[model samples]
Target: MAPSSDAAADGEPSGDVMTYHLKAEHELRIEVDFDRQVTVKLLSGDAEIFGCELPKGGAKTLSGVKCAIFTWHAAQIQIVGKPDACYEAEASAAMRSYLNLHTALEERRKAAVTTTSPTTKGPRVLVVGNTDAGKSTVCKILCSYACRADAMHGGVAAAAGHDHWVPVFVDLDVGQNSVTPPGTICAVPVDAPVDPVDGWPGEAPLVYYFGHASPGENAAHYKALVESMARVLAQRETDDVLARAAGLVVNTMGWTDGLGYDLLLHAISALSIDIVAVIDHDKLTAQLKAHVGSQGGDVQVVKLPKSGGVVTRDTNFRKRARDRMIRSYFYGSRSELNPCASAIDASSFKVFRVGGGARAPNTALPLGATSRMDPLRVAPLPMTRDLERCVLGVLHGDNAALGDADVLSKPCAGIVCVTEVDASRGKVHILQPSPGSLPSKLLLSGTMRWND
Candidate 1:
């Protein structure tokens, strides 16, 4: 496709549209800028964005995203607007590798379905990689493939005596979470392919607030959330045979050194991971293999090459993405959401922060004493100006009976943002998803804040 030389005063697309014919096993990689929008439509043949099949003749608008339109067979696509970067590649080893891994996992799923024993459950895969190594993409592709009945049954109809797989997608990346807002980890069952425009389904995600983007801020708190999530998923799989056979696809944050690496290992054990997919990192791969050997587990550590089209996002870009996630929660992605803002007395709900207290230096302590603060302690947050623009996690439990330990493990119902705090009237204004009172009065605070 050649660049158009059309005249448009506002820099929008005029009449010149471009079309590209992708060969078999090829992909069209595109990167759109944050400020601009691009429209893409499939003209002919089968093509998919991420793993969701593109609807023929329907124009899908994309902005501030870097994605690929892949086709197992040949495909023809049309573009109406210019992207920051666009190109078609004839070969993509990363996509091939992802498909192969999906195939092996499918075999495990089939075997799990044949047995009622929990020991023969399907593969629980944990994907670990550096930032921008396409870990999220890998997870999405795997989950999408798992939900594709045609792919599983070799082009046969799913109604032909076969049930669809509902594999669980666990997102541990707090900084840029695809399942839920930032500063939290969540899991959702994927019964269908994820939308290319809208990432994951939002029906009933199990979310835990970590209060900060990076796990390094409170590594203990993060690990506790992981353990809680694993426990809940284990119970869920135990009760549901299909979900157990479908298993899980876990995505981890891109901090793979020292404490970060230790957290990864802890997650593997906590989640009962069967396959550890290391994306484009040899040292991490080897280290994981060695650790698995020492632990005497059946964890298969496979190293996969990172896609060349994976874009490296800077700090500012990541911050903007996080803000978008927050904004999207209250105000939908296309401004389709109308959140209700209400003013309630400050005393109506209790806001608590997890982990942060005065800590004396270890050097200043007695010979055998440790001055470390309890990182899991939950303390009440004072209502003040600091609460302004802060995002609060609405916990799911009895407000009066919730203990500190419950705060650490309880799944959040939803999130609310503090719009205004009136100390004079002892009132606080908050914006929530629906037009009703909060599900619970126990709110959890973290470092996440939204301007709007």
Candidate 2:
């Protein structure tokens, strides 16, 4: 609902500040332009952004984002600076369903605490839907809810020989990842509420470089990466009882047709996902249900409604968001990071691209059969001027004896961008976020590029 003329007049042309009074179960959604900033402060009562509780009287400065400030009870909020759009919405229905689902998952976690069966595990939930359906928002809400539960009952759980509830958030959406930068898939343990401004923390995240915005660019490689992430998660759950009980909340890309659909099924099986939450998409829900029924597995497919507060972003907006994400990795979201720029000998390390090599010649193939390239092939790329402005994933572990298989399965320590390739000097100048030497000599290349 638009603020009345009286409310708009009080601040619009004067101080450029506006006050919004929201009733219970209502939300104020605002979309801040990429070039602007908006400061949000909770004036009175209780409210939260996504699932993170907003600090009373504290201001959160946000830019280039579209978010909702939801209040479970009546509240007053103040906004400074003009956003592209702002409105109030009644979000009781969608929020209620989300809370109910969280409650059900919580019950399972409680049961897992006392269960002796080795086969028993917490809810391995997967969220799937079309583009702009609020899949990532749902993931954040669930993770935050789980973390809040842990904060309240962690001491009790610890007393009973259980660790704090730390839900693993697996993000398979390379286009707009939650934890890491774009063109990467990662899983991070969430034990605290995700900050509305800063998002998920970067502490000890298991990251893999997928090298492209969409999985369709290399479906085989993407599936392989998914399997690798699942393997690591399985091992973690087996070793930690609390983590096993706390379970996982997986976020996937918005692609949900053809190859996208096939990849979803593969992820469900590889991750042993038990709960498939489909948001506001009946066709996807029905397809998943039928497939699950035919396979006769323990997977539960549930339909969820998308929040009305979600604003649809155009292609240009998404591109700008991706660019900002990459930039934030080096400069920090608030320009608090001082990325080191240094030059290293080209021969000191190696760069490799996966699955883009040339196919075998027709003469080498059998008659009447076509030659096809191996999508998993590891091809070494030469250091040259062409590598300038390219983003590279710094692979972890021993690069001394890396092989094709290791390249596909190995996780990255971090990422760097090639600023300049000095061919005459045989040096590669790179921009690194931290002021440390490269962890390994193995670097992976993708199609992502950044100039600044």
Candidate 3:
């Protein structure tokens, strides 16, 4: 309510720091506002003060003024006047608080819709290849480029040519993770990638392991791998890591058979992802197409460089064919959805995170809220010439075998696949399209095998 006499008592308080810098042709105007008489003073790296004071009012700052405040601190702006002479003290504090709050709110708003500025560093690119395909050589080239570019430009271009840049390097390749092998770049595993710059360890990405599964040897380990992969991907997706991935490189083991194909399909299905790019393996590409066709998805094929596909194998010339396949995996249109703008140089085995793998309600089971093991049973279609084709396929496919399955209404096209509980009891299941509602013309029935 009342003014503080102490604050106004001094024209310039002791122990307060201030500084002033003067450039050529600049005027430093310091206004001395006081209810009482006071003197003006400017102290710092040599600054001249010119101004006059009309005695009745106070000393007015004069001409030939040289005042420029660039970036100098510890200087002084002092006022000598009677106690309680400057303007109300409370008003100044209120202005300071308002400005601070306004600035903070503005910053928060900017964060919502900001794109990466190019002045920031670019992401670190790590390239890895299978042993024979010159994995080390690729690393060498990357390092050569990264080091030279960083040296010349001061650092990896932090300028977010797009989004962000992390200045970190880590390695975790089971047993082969080493960038210091002298010729090729070493692999880094999640357990021990590069150390964190500020306060965290390197983050591990899911290895998109694109190789063919080992055959005839579906040992316990294979199952374990599947479970482990599922669990890992689940954790990452839940934690939002999958959402942040830029691009993934999938390295397949040099084989393309049922095991590899199945494993690859299961993995993709598990992630429910549309592949972005293809590596230079023709065998893998064909398998990929088969799976995509089944799922009604589209993908671009990128073949590897033909010139680089030369490698020594079975016969000198035949090995050439193998080399071409390897290069082809690297060929394809850009993965339309690489979270990162750049293609990840690592194999795909590491990037695919487990996504929502929940299966839809079984269409053949007449979905219910309770038990899910029952089969959807509908009566055999009444002999109608138009429905003969549909009836034939179902009968062969075990649609007519069910005593309880009564044809409910208009005969549908074809039953897709079926599941069985007991193999010895001759139990079969028939799958149907996920129709929205039961067709009025057919009486849909469901059957469950009660082996007990």
Candidate 4:
């Protein structure tokens, strides 16, 4: 059905509300304008937007949501916001290309089963692009389509008592990670369709904390985490038939210049990516083509169009997004989690910084010699005032004598946000995931600090 526009009256003051009625098997697609916001609510009947289920009588506010399609068997929705543009299209052409890619992978997966050596794997795709280029959206679409295909083929695989059907999703974008909380790189198995709106559910993904919001904060640390994740994924693919057949779809950060480009190359090499999908950047696409060709490897570089509906976010918006991610971690997206708040003695804990607060230039250090300070050094904190309002990573390792490099390499059990710090009393107030004492007293600090 066509959308009907109405000016807000009485209780509704925005005056930009539009209502749409959808029949069975119909969809209403929307593309919010650049730098604008949209609020969508299910008015009646059963409806869902993306993978997230809309509350029966609640509304969801979307900021910088580029393009979203709401589908339902029979339902009505009231959208009280203006969009840059909105249209009804069955599917974009880029989606068709993605499907073709999936088809090719499926053929490879089947061929691998017939080969004498079952070590042959499907395509390992790495999606890279600048900010707001719809990298995440493309990853979701690819993952969802792959999951659907797996479901169709699962019955036969199940009859054989082989259950390795789900594809693996590696979230390397710590800035806006979909599988786990922010400041973490995760690897999750996707056996079912991903919620388009909510992305991946908060699954217990294999996580490694980078302890910073941006890659530029500690490039060495970020690259180290990437290598660690790559090693884990490689081992899984080797050991698990399903994972091997499914391969990996790695979603990366939007940093495509200078050190960002260097980090990207590091990831590409470490993951041994077979396909590099560059979204809407000619320079980056060309660079990857040359780099991969120069390396004498059979890596395919394909260019994908950026959706017109992608919204560009400013600095403030990104900060808010980070804050929301942290909040969602402790409280959950629907406020379903009840985290515990506790106070502890500051003297009992030791806070360490990773990568030694970024590296200095080679010129700054003496020739043929490095700085005395180590990049992974985990020096002790004096329980000073700077500890207040900072987010500290709860280390997974129990060894208190672990060196700085060892501590930086270890994954975190969870995170705690410091609320207050009292030097005289040696008491530190923190918001933690559970009550009682923390898992470990070896807390690692980074440049990331949160107020709420």
* lDDT top scorer: 2
Each candidate's TM vs. the true structure? 0.94, 0.94, 0.27, 0.83
Error of 1 at 6 (Å): 11
lDDT to native, each model: 0.87, 0.88, 0.27, 0.74
lDDT of 2: 0.88
How well does candidate 2 score on lDDT at residue 269?
98
**Superposition error at 199 for model 4 (Å):** 2.7
Off by over 4 Å in 2: 1-15, 150-156, 159-164, 357-372
> Over 4 Å off in model 3, which ranges?
1-216, 240-243, 271-273, 276-280, 298-300, 306-310, 313-452
Ranking by lDDT: 2, 1, 4, 3
Model 4 is weakest, by summed lDDT over 10 consecutive residues, at 151-160
In terms of lDDT, the poorest run of 10 residues in model 2 is: 4-13
The predicted structure with the larger lDDT, 3 or 4, is: 4
lDDT of 1 at 308: 78
